[model samples]
Target chain A: MTIYLPIAELSVNIFVILGMGAAVGFLSGMFGVGGGFLITPLLIFYNVPPVVAVATGANQVVASSVSGAISHFRRGTLDIKLGLMLLAGGLAGATVGIWIFSFLRRLGQLDLVISLLYVIFLGFVGGLMLIESINAIRKTRKGVVPVKAPGQHPWIHRLPFKMRFKKSKIYLSVIPVIGIGFGIGVLTSVMGVGGGFIMVPAMIYLLRVPTNVVVGTSLFQIIFTTAYTTVVQAATNYSVDIVLAFILMVAGVVGAQYGVRVGQKLRGEQLRALLALLVLAVGIRLALQLVITPADVYSLAIGGVHG
Target chain B: MKRALLATLTLLGLVAASPAPAFAQALSPPAQGSVVERLEIGMNTSQIAITPDFAGADLAIFGAVVNADELLNSIGQYDIVVTLEGPKDFATVRRKERVFGIWINRHSVTFKEAPMSYTLSSTRKIEGEPGVPPLDAPGIGIQHIDLTPTDFLRGGRLLEDFRDAYRRLKMESGLYQPDPGGVRFISSTLFQANLKLPANIPSGTHTVRAALFKSGKFIMEKTLPLRVVKTGLEQAITDAAHQQPLLYGMASVFLALLTGWGASVLFRRD
Candidate 1:
């Protein structure tokens, strides 16, 4: 039941890893989000080396994103133009992220920085999602019909160099789209997440792209960004474990299929609320670890002696 | 002169009894002592091939002491201590401090040469036993392992704390084990011990040392070589990653894309 991971240099139960992959995959499929944020932290909790967890998590994202993107493409919901624009920025951002990752690793601050980033981002995103979902649910319970807003936000309209995305039926400035992609790309490399949760909301609210196209467009861009991250981590850090990635991907794909079916039976507000709670729980746990006094204050790492 | 002759005779007896032909070549010249001692060691296996499914391994180190006179044997004063040490490597130990209400690594000490894994086993309690000499003085326990910091002068009491912390962590991780009473004597001259190599054991040549103590004093010591290596798929993957990292990286990306595409096509419903 236990298998040895060559890159991670540890033994883990096969079923445990498979279950983790399936659970995260199911959530991602249901929510239209890449589950890297969940999977990476779970792996770290299971004592997988942090470097291996982050790198391999990105590799798994490549698979899920590719599958999700293709599905959207076939359904004619993908915004190819928007996806490509975001990808350009994502690629550039990922390169910078990798450099920062290496610098922090050399200083032995990579784990601390990673945990801190997770706590901050997850808390903010989760809190926002929870509040928004609760309000939407209350409105529906009060028998108030939901209304859709027309036109872009005032801030978005003020941006220069607007371009039309025919697929999403929108005209937006390239600067903000590229900036959003760049931010997602950095997250992909550094945090091993596809940044779908952030990207989906940004597209719906900030860019004012149609809700129907947001998930597809986000998945499309994530495929390339995460693929690039996987390669860079493998080459530069030698941290990616192909075996671990492959196993997780296989289970994740199967889980995603079941998740899609389950998602159809659930209401959007309920699903969002659940996901928000999950994210908040993980974030709070990580934050608590930082604030709590550790039983042992010392940690060891393999490297040359440094004064 | 008589003691040296007896030691030579005992060495010849050991060479004749040893199963491994290479053991003869590894022996050093006999040390000067009032009573000469002879050691012969045998391992369950000399080479441990770490296959893909290798969870861990248990090794039995059984050996014998020869050339003891009747007077020494009657007193029953001999003790056996065995240590298995993995390849030497540098390790950095960092201490965390609360800064602005968040714990963060503030200072670190580096050990110049530390074993990746070390297991110590003794026939009797190594330290703090009634009427027994402290093992630290004789370098017989895990605490007594010669660990020197890179910047020895800079680290004063802090260096000692780091060293203790490092040992504690290693012990918790099962990489450093100090097992008193792990060794047992089948008879006065024959002794055996068991030590486990954790699944995360580093792959390299490991040194197995056995020392014989007489009347709370060091008498003689012997060393055996053991090899731990990755085999088959584990070796292939590790070698590829280290040697052809770029190619390996490309392959990983390509594989992910192919699998993703294949899964989508295979599961497509329409």
Candidate 2:
């Protein structure tokens, strides 16, 4: 039994925390998920203040992305221009998301709203990816060129200011790209996440960005958004514990390197399936909280005795 | 003549038994009491003086445990309560009741004046000088023996003001200021009592007594017979901090990096 001290009450055993960190860090590195989904729930289970846990988990995303970004940079997979464009949109979206969060919270419906959003988004995205991946595998086995559904929305094509994405081999209007970025940012701010999982799929399927650039750009956006979150929380709320940040950063970095190596051996379809499954599991958990009668009521303690 | 002789004999007996009552009474530790002992001296005494002395603040008296064998091996505890008497110069003086050494799962500081339980940590001649260290750091320091309630003073408001003043003094003294360290100990486990003088406080000797109480009773008491001079000693700690701001800042950053990096390395699998 590990006896956690004052701050550690919500902190698991160092070994366990490290293990969890490593797992989350690895997944984040390979698939570009922020790992907030895993870290926040675990912290809540350990009895950390819900708000603090969310903010702190977001802070660690910055570190997680740093390690993955380095690997992608080294592999010549980074797309700086694309990354910057997404970041610009992400910042604007994040500000909007925060505003929406406060508004919902004031209305006493934040939890319900966020939970509904998670289930809808995750189920839709996961199902879509599963089907697309299966189709890709089938086409590959038959030695046939895979057919993709054409994005025939006239407005998406006719919007003003068409721009070139050399790496993605597409010239499309910048409005949709910026809109996607802003929408992801809003979700990121509300959920206290890096928005990588959402951004990756959007870039690959919707924006038609190349796979190589998707992961790198998603991580790039994560880095900037998380950094912005850190500053905002620190200055306004004093919620960022540099100490806590450092601990998670260390674990996340090492996990990143390992994830990259393992990711290299795995097939892309398999990795995507695993990512989808993970997101689905989290989505189900969030949805259950709404309909299920809680097993306990009149909670006993404000803080747990030694996490 | 017979009547006169009888009256004279009665008068002689009264004088003979006067000292018996005084000798029979001995202060004993209560069933669940505790004791704490500190030495006290005159207010004008030097910070380095190592001799025992008597001191009074607002006439608040304190006593030290010169001979406490009766409390040495008792079954019940002898929690100690130290109080400063006389001048109410500091806010801690009002909370004279809260100052004490406590046992586990005990009630708040006892209010009764019964003998309390105690364990002797040390005994020494309390030195008053320019460089005396803080008493709560768990070390053997100055010692004096007195039983006065007004000798020491502390309060929450006072502590806050003292901290602010200390920070300003450090700044003025060319000392560095950074993040104040985290509170590692909780209230029941440990507490601090610091005395501060208002600007109008007399610039002369001040007497303070540290008293020990256990289970609501006074057990062992000690007096800090030191003086409040024109110079400030608490400022020294602030100055040291301000003088090394870089060291403090780097320490904070290093701590962050170490924990962050360590978490990364420890969690990484080959």
Candidate 3:
């Protein structure tokens, strides 16, 4: 039957959007990340405007992250101290990201830059992680003693302004933490992403936060940042439509739960490898678009008035 | 020869069998000897300079109103319509006429003006006071005008605004129902309805009829034949906007960073 979709301004199968939400949710739930990399492209494929997709996706991220965060908290896997620090950095980063977005928009080249960065970052990071994880898994299978604790790099000790992390048992400079925040912020704004994938890894490797805390801290930051992003984009940009966000969020919460469960079953090395590979694949695809002359190119501006 | 004759006769018979209203119920033929009086379609500023690039296209007519003094004075709710008669292109997918009536203000209540002429008649160009006639373009084509931005305005067109709000609320709450065809129509507070073109739309001049109805009666009728040329770049832009906003947004960001990395570096240095 022909159903009129308010968003598409056409009659469509009612299940198309709902099913999309569910599918993305299941995958995201099956995996321990926001399914944005999938959802945004899927929406784009359906010809949803990029602005709406990003804004709506941000809205969905909040819901999914909240659900995931709560579950992790229940498991006592969340490192509240580290999560707070990351949140501080994430918020600062988000504000800066917003400013950068506005400035780039004025120059009229935001889309090209965002795609290029995504392809580059996701591809490189994903490739490295996948390779490393595969090796770790292979070594573990071979009965090699898996490292009991993360290695203490000498540089982390020499960095000025060392502070003790009681839970992580590592003291590190605040500068790197702030820098990490700033970097994640820039990435989030540019790519319209939550920066969770970036955050989790950085927390674990750079800041020496425990692995259990990484996902929780990232989720903590994402919830706040994305929620703020939604309101700002909505009230100022008139881009956020709560209805669209709510629908996706409901599906995402269920998806995230399943994803986390599946994630728990796999060894850390294998999961990292898979995630890293996925990132690399998306990154490479995005990078190619930049190097290649696009089959079609277009530009647009806000046509509708904002409230 | 016999088969060909039979085919022609069969075609004639099929045409004859089509439904026709009884004589008394039939629509009256247009008035006789009516002076053309400088025919022009009312349109929004956006629709001006519309160029059609496709064969057999339909153009939008908007911001039109009938200037009957008697109708103006006795309005609790009144419908204003414009009709396009004579030549037209393409078939109507769906059509609805919009009538916006704002209350006259104290200062303009006593002001009297002559029947508006077709010259400078489009609503956007209306040089009138802040009253009902001036508030809404007296006659608006429901199928042509975009009401989104206007609806977003704080005090623009209240009735349409209210309707849109209601629709949003209903849809969000999951109270809205889809029709049997799976198309759920939330009432539009916006001005335009996109008319879909059939794939096999025939080219040529055809009669275009438009009327405004209030309480199921035609209030005004306007007929103007327009040549169907090609559809404009509007659809393409719309499609692109919907299909790839992130790609567009991200690309914009990438260019900024290329330039902004220097700025970021400079700020860091500072």
**Number of the top-ranking candidate, with TM-score as the measure:** 1
Candidate 2 wrongly placed segments (more than 4 Å): A1-12, A147-155, A264-268, A299-307, B1-270
DockQ of each: 0.49, 0.04, 0.03
| lDDT (Cα atoms) of all candidates against the true structure | 0.77, 0.50, 0.47
Task: Please give, for residues A134-247, the per-residue lDDT of candidate 2 as tens digits.
Answer: 766676678886465545456678888898877657788888888899999988878777767788878877887766667766776777676666556544544444434555
Instruction: Give the DockQ-based CAPRI class for model 2.
Output: incorrect
Task: Encode model 1's per-residue lDDT on A33-120: one tens digit a residue.
Answer: 7777788988987878777888888888777667666766776768999999988988888778767776777877666878798799
Of the true interface contacts, what fraction does each candidate have? 0.68, 0.04, 0.00
lDDT of 2 at A194: 70
Which candidate, 1 or 3, has the higher TM-score? 1
Interface RMSD, all models, one decimal each? 2.1, 17.5, 20.5
RMSD of candidate 1 to the truth, in angstroms, is: 6.7
On a 0 to 1 TM-score scale, where does candidate 1 land against the true structure? Answer: 0.86
DockQ, structure candidate 3: 0.03
